[model samples]
Target: MWRDLLPIGRHRGSGGYRRFAWTAADTDCRAWFKAQAEARGLSFELDRNGNQWAWLGDPLAGDAVVTGSHLDSVPDGGAFDGPLGVVSSFAALDELRRRGAEFARPLAITNFGDEEGARFGLACVGSRLAAGQLTVDKAHELRDADGVSLPEAMERAGQDPGTIGPDPERLARIGAFVELHVEQGRALDLSGDPVGIASAIWPHGRWRFDFHGEANHAGTTSLEDRRDPMLSYAATVLAARQQARLAGALATFGKIAVEPNGVNAIPSLVRGWLDSRAADQGTLDTVIAGIEAAAHEHADRDGIDLSITRESFTPVVEFQHALRDELAKLLGGAIPVLGTGAGHDAGILSASAPTAMLFVRNPTGISHSPAEYAAEDDCVAGVVALADVLEGLACR
Candidate 1:
C-alpha cells in the first residue's frame, strides 16, 4: 500500500507531496482509497462533504468503531503527515483479520477531505462541515488562491456540493473514532516510545494582516517620501516573533501576498497570514493581542492602513478521557500521554463523537516539509498498536 501511494503526488524538484484538495493528485489519492476499500471487500462510501469511508459489517449499524485519517497534503508537504494514518488503518485491519479477531461492532476507515486546508485556508473542512462547526453559507463562500470556489471545486471533482452540510445522523452512528498519525513533534521520540496517546490540542488560529499604502517606483522614490506597506508588514512579522517568544507560544507568517508584485516597484498592499498557537486559550489570546497591537503601531507610524481578519480559529480540544484511557490501557499502561500544538481531524470530530489519537514516533520531529519522516520500525509499531487498539475496542 505504501509503495503504491509513494509516487502519487510527489514532486520531482522538491521531493514532497502536492496532493491539494480536489486537484488531480487528490483525485489519484481518492481513487487509490476506493481501490483499497474494494480490494478489501469493505463497503465503500462517499459522504456529503466528500469524505471517503470503507465499512465492514452493516452500514446502518449503530455504535460503529471508525478509524482512519485524511490523505491530502499541505504545499510541498511530507509523505507521512496525513498518509501515514490512512496506510496504517488499512494495515491494521489486515493485521486484525490475520489474528482472527471477531468484531462486536461495525468498523469503518475514513479519509476526510481538505484536511490540510492548503487550498482553501480552512483546516478540517470535511469534518467541520459534518460536525456543523462550519455553516453551509460560509462554506459556499470559501475560495482558493486562483479564485475557485469550494463548491465549484467539489463539482469539478464529481461531488455534489448541494449536499454539503451537517450530517448529524452519520456522526451519531459512530460510537468511537480513533485516528493514528505520525507525531508532528518529538514527544514519542524523546520518551523512547514508538506510540503515544494524544491528550489535547492547543488553541490555534490563522489571522490575515493587510497593510495598505502608496505604490511608487522603488528606484525613484525617496525613502522618507515613500509610504511602503512592506515596511509595516516586515515590522509586524518581527513583532509577531517577539511576542510569541515572550509568551512562550508559536507564531508564524508562513504565507503572504503583495499587490503589484515587482522587484522595481513598492507594493501598495502587503497581506501576511499569521498562524499562532498556545497550550491554552488565555495564552493564545494574549499572544495574538500583543501581535495585533504591534502591527497597528507599525502601520500607524508608517501611515499604512491596516486591517486584520481572522481566517480560522480552533479552541483547545481535550480528547475524551474515557477513550484516551482505553487506548492507553490497550497499548499497555507504560505508554506516554502527551499534548500537541498541532490540530487534527480527530480534534474536529471530538465535538460530535468520542475521538482519540495515537501518534507514531518521528525521529526528527519535523513535519509539513520534505524532511518529515518516521522510521520503518516505528511505522510498523504504529500499525500494530492501532491493530491492538481496534481489537480491544471493536473485537471485544
Candidate 2:
C-alpha cells in the first residue's frame, strides 16, 4: 500500500507531496483509496461532505467503530503526516483479520477530504462541515489563491457541492473514532516509546496581517522618504517570535503575499499569515495580543496602515477520557499520554463523537516538510498498536 501511494503526488525537485484538495493529485489519491476498499471487500461510501469510507459490516448499524485519517498534504508536505494513519488503518484491518477477530460492532475506515486545507486555507474542512462547525453559506464563500471557489473546485472534480453540509445522523452512528498519525513532534522519541496516546490538542489559530503603504521604485526611493509595508512586516515577524517565546507559545509567518512583487519595487501591501498555538487558551490569547500590539506599533511608526483578520481558530480539545484511558489500558498501560500543539481531524470530530489519537514516534520531530519521517519499526509498532485498539474496541 505504501509503495503504491509513494509516487502519487511527489514533486521531483522538492521530493515532497503536493496533494492539494480537488486537484488531479487528490483525485489519484481518492481513486487509490477506493481501490483499496474494493480490494478488501469493504463497502465503500462517499459522504455528503466528500469524505470517503470503507465499511467491513452493516452500513446502517449503530455504534460503529471507525478509524483512519486524511490523505491530503500541505504545500511540499512530508509523506507521513496524513497518509501514515490511512495506510496504518488498512494494515491494522489486515492484522485483525489474520487474528480472526470476531467483531461485535460494525467497523469503518475513512479518508476525510481537504484535511490539510492547502487550497482553501481552512484545515479539516471536510470534518468541520460534517460537524456543523462550518456553515454551508460560509463554505460556499471559500476561495483559493487562484480565485477558484470551493464549490467550483468540487464541481471540477466531479463531486456534488450542493450536498455539502452537516450530517448529524452520520456522526451519531459513530460510537468511537480513533486516528493514528505519525507524531508531529518528538514526544514518543524522547520517551523511548514507539507509540503514544494523545491527551489534548492545544488551542491554535491562523491570522492574516495586512500592512498597507505607498509603493515606489526601490532604487529611487530614499530610506527616509519611502513608506514601505515590508519594513513593518519584517518588524512584526520579529515581534511575533519574541512574544511567542516570552509566552511559551508557537508562532510562525509561514505564508505571505506582496503587491507588486518585484525586486525593483517597494511593496504597496504585505499580507502575511500567522499560525499560532499554545498549551491553553489564555496563553494563546496573550501571545496573539502582544504580537498584534507590536504589529500596530511598527505599522504606525512606518506610516503604514495595518489590518488583521482571523482566518480560523480551534479551541483546545481534550480527548474523551473514557476512550483515551481505554486505549491506554488496551495498550497495556505502558504507552505514554501526551498533549500536542498541532491540530487534527480527531480534534474537530471530538465534539460530535468520542474521538482519540495515537502518535507514532518521529525521530527528528520534523513535520510538514520533506525531512519528516518515522522509522520502519516504529511504523510497524503503530500498526500493531492500532490493531490492538480496534480489537479491544470492536471485537467480541
Candidate 3:
C-alpha cells in the first residue's frame, strides 16, 4: 500500500523525494495513482487546474467527503513530507473495505499540483486556482526556473490551460477536507506521541527583491568605484535575518540570482526571494516591513536601484475544531492539537472549507530536506490514526 503511494527513490537514490509536480518523477507518481484508483473501482477525473480526483461514489454529489494531500516535494525532501497522507488515506480506505462498514457518503482522494512551489515560483498552485485565489491568466504567466511557462508546461503534460480556473461546482462537493501528513517538525515527538490534530497554521508568504547596479570589470574598478548590486542584496539578506530575529518571526532568503555572475565582473543586478511567516498577520506585516526598509536602506547606501514585489501571501489558518475534537476522541481522547509554523495545502483549504489535519510524528525536527523521517512504528500508528479520523469524519 505504501509503495504504491510512495515510489522508493523518488529522487533516484539521493536519499530524498524529488516529485516536483508535472515533472518526470511527479508524472510517474500520478500514473501510479491512476492505476491504484482504477484497481479500487474509483473514477478518475482531472479538474480545470490539473488537480486529480478519484471518486469512490457518485461523482455529482454536492458535498462528498474529501481526503488527500499533495505529492510534490522539495528538491531533496524526505519520503513522508507529502505522499504519506495521500498513501495513508488509500491504505485506510482499503482497510475500511475489508470491514464492509455501511456507508452512504461519497469519498474522494485528490492529488493537488505544484503544492511545494519547487518548480513554479508559487506554492499551492492547484488549490489556489480552484479556490479563486489565483487567476488563470497569472497562472499561465508563471514559469519554472528553466523558463517554461506554466501554460506551456500544462500543454506539454496533455492539459488545457484555457480550461483552468475557479472550480466552485467541484469544490462545493467536498464537505470536509482532511490531510494526513508526516509531522514536518518534531512537535508530536516532543509530546511523546505518534499523532496529532492540527490547531492552526502560521501566516506565511513570499516576496522578490530586485536590485540593479552598473556592471564593471573587477580588475579595472576599485572598491569605491563600483556600484555593485550584490552589495545591496548581501546587506538585505543580513537585514532580513536581523528583522525576523527582532520580530520573533520566521524569515528566509533562500533563492537568489545575479546577472553577469563571473569571477572578474561586478554583478549588474541581483534578484532574490524572501519567505516570511508568523503566527499573526500583524507580526508578519512587521517582519516584512522591516525587511523592505532594510532593503531600501541598503540600496541607497550602495547606490543601486531596488524593487520589491509581493509574490503570494497566505494568512493564518485555524482548523475546524468540531472535526478536530472528533478526531481526538477517535484516537482515544489523548490526542494533542498543535500549530505549525509552516504553510500547508490544508491551511489554504481551511480558509473557506471545513478542514483539519492529522500529523504523524517525526523523530527529527527537520523537514523540507533528505533528513526528515518517521519510523516504521510511527508510520503504522499514523495510519491507524488516519483511519480513525476518516471513519469519524465520513460517518458524520
Candidate 4:
C-alpha cells in the first residue's frame, strides 16, 4: 500500500527519503497526517515540546490511549521506520471505526519529532524532552555538524525554544503507547512470521571519537614522518569490528569524516562515531571499552591524540507485562515475540507509561538503507494486528 506513497516525499534522488524533522519534507508529512486525521474527524494540536497529537475522542486531561511514530528519518532512511506507524495509526483508527468500535478513554496518535537523531543527533528528542528524561539545557545545546544549536533551529522553524522540555501535563495525558514499525533486523524473517509483538529494546548508545594527527604534504612527507589520522582511524575501525565480534555485541563505525579531505595531502583530525548496542548495560560497556582501548593503542602507534564524547545512552527496556499479555491473547497467543536492537520514541516513553510496539516483517532483513523492505501483504497484516490491539485496548 505504501509503494504508491513511497515516492511522494522520497529524496536523495535515487537513494531514498530525507524527511529530517522540522524541514519541508517533514512538515509535508505532517500535512499528510493532518489530512488523514481530519478525514477521520480527529483534531490536531501541538504540545509544548512540539510533538503533534491528533485526538480521536472527547477532550479529556488524563491517561489517553496513544499510537503513532516519528516522521523524521536519517538522510536516506527507508520509508517505513517512522511514517509506517503514523499512516498505520490512521489505518488502524479507520479499521476500528468501520468495526463500530467505541472507546471510553480518548485515543490520540502522535508524531514525535527528531526520532531519527539524523538532524539533531539525539535519539527520540521530542519524547525524551517531553517526558523529562532529558534536560532542556542539554536539548538546546545539541549541535549539528554545521554548528546550529537546537534552540536556534527551533526558533528558525517558528517553534519556541523555551517550551522544549518536560511537559509534565503532556506526559500525564498519555496512558498507553503502541508504535507499529518495520523490523530493523532479521528477527521476524527467521521466525517466518509476518508480524510479532516486541519483547524488549536492546541497550544502545552513541559515542564520538576524535583523532588528531599532522596535516602534511603528500609529496614531501616520508612514510616514517607522516602521522596520518586516517591510518589510525582505519586501525580503530578494524579493531572495533574485531572487539565487537569477540564480545558478541554489535559495534559499528558507521559515520566518519576527515578534516581537510584532500587526496593529495595526509589528512589531519579524522573523526569516528561509534554506535554500540547489546543485550544489557554490561555488554554495552564492554563493547565501548574495547573500542576505547583500540583508540588508545592506535593513537600511540600513530602519534595522534584522541578524545571520546558520549552523545546519548539508553538502557534496555521491557514492555509492560499486563498490556503485552492482553495483546498476546488478542493475537491468539500465536504472535511472535522478539527484542529489537533499534531504538524508538516508544522506548523513551515506556518509562512513564505503558508502552508496546508491533513489528512488520522485512524480507530483506535490512533497514536504515535504500534496500530496506516490507511486503504489501505484510503491511496490511501489521495494520490488522495494530487494529486488533487498539480494539482490545480501547474497548476494554
Candidate 5:
C-alpha cells in the first residue's frame, strides 16, 4: 500500500510529500481510496464534511467501529505521519479478510479531510464540522495563502460548499473511533517498543500575528524614515522562542507571509503563525501571553501596528481512561501507554466519540518534517495491533 501511494504526491527533490488538502494530490488519494474500497467489495461514500468512508458491512448498522487517518501532509512532510494509519487500516482489513473474520457490527475505514490545516489555516476542519464544532459559514470563509476561500477550494475538489456542515447522523453512528498513527515523538523509541497506546494529547493552539507598516523601496528607504513591521515580526519570533524556552513549552513560527514579497521592496505587512503546545493549559496560556506582550512592545517601538488572532485552540485531551486500559489489556499489557504533544483528528473526535489512538514507533522521533520515520517492521506491527483491537470491538 505504501509503495502504491508513493507517486501520488511525492516530492522529487526532498523525497517528502506535499499532499495539502483539496489539492490534486489529495484528489488522487481520494480516488485511490474509492478504487481500493471497490476492489474489496465495500461500499464507499464521501460525507457532507468531505470525509471519505469505506464500510465493510451495512452502513446503517448501529454503533460502528471506525479506524483510519487523514492523507494531507505538511509541507515537505515525511512519508509516515498521516498515511501510516491509512495504509495500516487497509493492511489490517486484508489480514482480517485472509482469516475470514466476520464482524457483527459495521466497520469503517475513513480518510478525514484537512487534518493538518496546512492550506486552510484550520486544523481538523473536516472532523470539527462533522462534530458541529465549526459552523459552515465560518469554514467557507477560511482563506489560503493566495486568498482562495475554503468554499472555492471545496468546489475545486468536486464537493458542494453548501453541504459542508455538521453531520450529526454520521457522527452518531460511530460507537468507537480509533486512529492508528505513527508516533510523532520518541516515546516508543525510548521504550524500544514497536507500538504504544495513546493516553493523552497536550493542549495546543495556533495564533496569527499580523504587523502593519508602510511599504517602500528597500534600496531607497532610509533607516530613520521607515516603519518596518518586519522588524517587529522578527523580534516577536525571538520572543516566542525565549518565552517558550523559559516556560518549558513548545512554540514555533512555522508559517509566514510578507506582502509584496520581493527582495527589492520593504514589506508593508507581515503575517506569521505561531503554534504553541504545553503539558498543561496554564503553561500554554502563559507562554502565549508573554509572546503576545512582547510582540506588542516591538510593534510600539517600531511605530507599527500588531494584532493577534487565534486560529484554533485545543485543550489538553485525556483519552477515556477505561478505553485506554481496555486497549492495553487487549494488547496483552505489553505495550506502553503514552502521552503526545501532537494534535490529531482523534483529539477532535474525542469531543463527540469514545476516541482512542494507537501509536506506532517512529525511529527518528520527529514529525511534521521530512526527517520523520517509522520502520517497516514497526508499521506491520501497528497493523496487527489495530486489527486485534477491531476484532475485539467490531467482531462478535
Candidate 6:
C-alpha cells in the first residue's frame, strides 16, 4: 500500500507527503481509491459531503459496518498518519477475500477528506460537516492561506459549494465506524505490543494569536524605539511551554507567520497558532488561559497590540465502551486499551456513531512529521486485527 502511494504527492526534497485536500494530488488519491475498490468488485459511492464510500454489498440494505480513514496530509507530514488507516482498510479486505469470508450485513470502506485541516484551518471538515457539527454557510466561508475559499475549492473539485452540509441520512447509515491507524505516539512501544484498541481521545484545540507592531527598516529602527510584536510572540511561546508543563497539559505554538518578513525590515505583525491538548477540559482551558494571560501581559508591556481567537476545539472523546469491548473481544482478550493525544476522524465520528480505533505500534513515537514510522510487520498486524474486528461485526 505504501509503495503504491509513494509516487503520489511525494515531496522529493523532504521525502514526506503534501496530500492537502481538494488539490490535484488529493484528487489523484481519490481516483486510486476508486480503482482499488472497483478492482475488488466493490461498488463505490460518493456522499454529498465529498466522503467516498466503497461498499462490498448493497449500501442501502442495512446499516453499514464502516471502516477506513482520510488520505490528506499535513504539510511535509509522515506517510502513515492518514494514509495508514486507508491502506489498512484495503489490506483487511484483501485478507478477508483470501480467507473467503462471507458477510451478512453491508461493509464499506470510506475515505474522509481534509482530516488534517492543514489547508483550510478546520480539522475534520468532512466528518464535521457530515455529522452536522459545522454548517454549510460557515464552511463555505473558510479560507486557506492562499485566500482560496472553501466554496471555491469545492467548485475546483467539481462539487457544488452550495450543497456542502450535514447529511443526516448518510450519517444514519453507519451502524459502527472503525478506523485503524498507526500509533502516533510511543504507548505501544512502551507496552511492547504491536496493536491496541483506542479508549479515548484527549481534548484538544487550536487558537490563533495575532500581534500588531510597527514595520520599520532594520537599519533605521533603534532597539529602544521599536515596538516589535515578535517579542510578545516569543514570550508567549515560552509561556506556553511553561504553563503546559506546570498544568500537565501539552501546548505548542507550532505555526507562525510574520508580515513584512524581509530580513532587513522589522516585522509589522506576528501571527502564531497554538495547538494544545490535555486529559481533561479543565486542565486544557486553564493551560490555555494561562498562556493567553501571559501573552496579554507581554503585549501590553511591550506596547504591542494582541488579539486571540479560538479557531477550533474538540472536547475529550471517550469511545463507546460497548463497541470498544466488542472489538477487544474480537481481536483477542489480551489486546491493550489505549488513549491518544492526537485527534482523528474516528474521534469526531464518535459523537454520531459507535466508533472505535485500532492502533499499530510506531517505534519512532512521532507523527505530523517525516520522522514518523511503523514497521511493516506491525502494519500487517494492524490489517489482520482490523479484519478480525470487522468480521465479528459484519460477517455474522
Specify the highest-lDDT model's number: 2
| Candidate 4: pairs in clash | none
TM-score versus the correct structure, for each prediction = 0.99, 0.99, 0.96, 0.96, 0.98, 0.98
Tens-place lDDT digits, model 2, residues 157-219: 999999999989999999999999999998888899999999999999999999999999999
Q: Among all windows of ten consecutive residues in candidate 6, which has the lowest summed lDDT? A: 1-10
Give the least accurate 10-residue stretch of model 5, judged by summed lDDT: 1-10
List pairs with backbone clashes in candidate 6.
none
Candidate 3 structure lDDT: 0.85
lDDT of 3 by residue, 165-188 (tens): 888888888888889888878878
Give candidate 1's error at residue 226 in angstroms: 1.0
lDDT (tens digit, per residue) of candidate 6 on 225-258: 9999999999999999999999988999989999
Better of 1 and 4 by lDDT: 1
Mark the regions of model 3 whose C-alpha exceeds 4 Å error after superposition.
4-9
**Residue 301 of model 4, lDDT score:** 90
- Candidate 6 Cα misplacement greater than 4 A, ranges: none
Error of 2 at 381 (Å): 0.8
- Report the number of clashing residue pairs per model: 0, 0, 0, 0, 0, 0
- For residue 78, model 2's alpha carbon misses the true position, in angstroms, by 0.6
Please, what are the lDDT tens digits per residue for candidate 1 over residues 1-396? 999999999999999999999999999999999999999999999999999999998979989999999999999999999899999999999999999999999999999999999999999999999999999999999999999999999999989999999999999999999999999999888889999999999999999999999999999999999899999999999999999999999999999999889999999999999999999999999999999999999999999999999989999999999999999899888899999999999999999999999999999999999999999999999999999999999996
**RMSD of candidates 1 onward, in order:** 0.6, 0.7, 1.6, 1.5, 1.1, 0.9
- Per-residue lDDT of 74-173 in model 5, one digit per residue for the tens? 8888888888998899889998888788898999999999999989889999999998889987897899988999989999888988888888889889
lDDT by residue (168-278, candidate 4, tens digit) is 777777788899999998888898999999999999999998999999999999999998988888998998898889888898988988988898989888998989899
| Candidate 4: count of backbone clashes, pairs at least 3 residues apart or interchain | 0
